[model samples]
Target: MQIFEAIIGHVEKRCEAKGKRLTTQRKLVLRALIDANQALSAYELVDYCKQYFGETIQAMSVYRILEFLEEVHLVHKLNMSNKYIVCSHIVEGHEQGIPQFLICSKCNKISEKIVAPETITGLQSHARQEGFTVVSPQLEINCVCDKCGQ
Candidate 1:
């Protein structure tokens, strides 16, 4: 609980730094994600808000809030699963690099990592050779977590 509050504070400060306000609705959405501690689809988030807060939040509103959170680097969207997770580095106050997500296929648990810049450069180079452009630097790898693997 202490850690969650700290993360929320950090995110609030970050948003303020960008001249943006983390409104109550946004905080509720963020809290839902933090409490779940896993990637969640916008619809799932809406259900969470309804279940936990007894508040009705539209999926479209959740998506817009998520977009704002992503813009502030407080959340990340997993392209592979079309789910959103709070950024892992928020509490650490670390500068973000290109994010890569290791997703547990069975449980949908996600581990976020910052890939080495050189590795991303190599991938971009390879893509360029194929006459392709790298649109987003985020990468998602599907795997089974140790517990699930066992």
Candidate 2:
């Protein structure tokens, strides 16, 4: 539980720094995401909040909370899986280089890591050559995780 508290504290600090409000409902939704062992869709989050917090959250509310969290960089939305994960940097109190997510295609488990700056620069250069702008630096690569690979 200490880990959750630390993450929550970091998020609170971030929200304060950004002049945003972390409402109770938003906190509950964020807590549910943080407690989850894997990424969860907003519908799954609704069920989780109901089961764990006794709060019957609607999908729309959860999505709004998720959007707010993402806006503050407290959570990340995995486009491929249509799920969300808390930003790994929250625990460290600072972000490193470009963040990348390695996702297990089978189980949808996600692991966050930082890729070297040169790697991203290379990809950006390649995109520029193709006349495509690199909007977000985040990358999500799908493959089977070790546990699932076994």
Candidate 3:
């Protein structure tokens, strides 16, 4: 299996700094997400772990890990697809702009993009004008990727 030692190390440090423990199963789960080209559901991650590591992981366990990772910003949950993908900015630590996802409906591939501050400000401004509270700044756009489009 491909290894992401650097990313794992960064996550380990981040988890420790946040007073959270990154368990072995959690690390493997993150690695599975990192290795995947598309978003994967918790069940899919269990299958991947069994296939690659010859280890059986329960879907519940994976779900818990995904929750923890999402809480720490090490992963992002795609609500539309019910799948999870690793955060692309993990290696860079904290990022400047909010992260937006371009999800390919055909292939389930997710590409990460940073929404410009101005655009986010505009969105917030519009929401304020409408008297709606901004819960989260993240955005997900549905589209076909180049590979799937062609």
Candidate of highest TM-score: 1
Task: Specify the poorest-scoring 10-residue window by lDDT in model 3.
Answer: 88-97
lDDT of 1 by residue, 1-150 (tens): 787788789888887877999999999999999998888999999999999889999999999999998988889998887889999887665668999889989998888889999999999999999999999978999999999999
Model 2 deviation from the true structure expressed as Cα RMSD, one decimal place: 1.8
Writing each residue's lDDT as its tens digit, candidate 3 over 1-150 gives: 425987788779988988999999999898888877568999999999999888888999999999999988888888777889888888776743688998878877778988999999999999999999788888999999999989
Collision pairs in model 1: none
Local distance difference test, per candidate? 0.90, 0.86, 0.86
Worst 10 residues of 2 by lDDT: 88-97
lDDT of 3: 0.86
Predicted structure 2, TM vs. truth: 0.88
Off by over 4 Å in 1: none
In angstroms, give how far residue 99 of model 2 lies from its true place.
1.8
What TM-score, computed on C-alpha atoms, does each candidate reach? 0.94, 0.88, 0.86
Clash count in backbone of candidate 2: 0
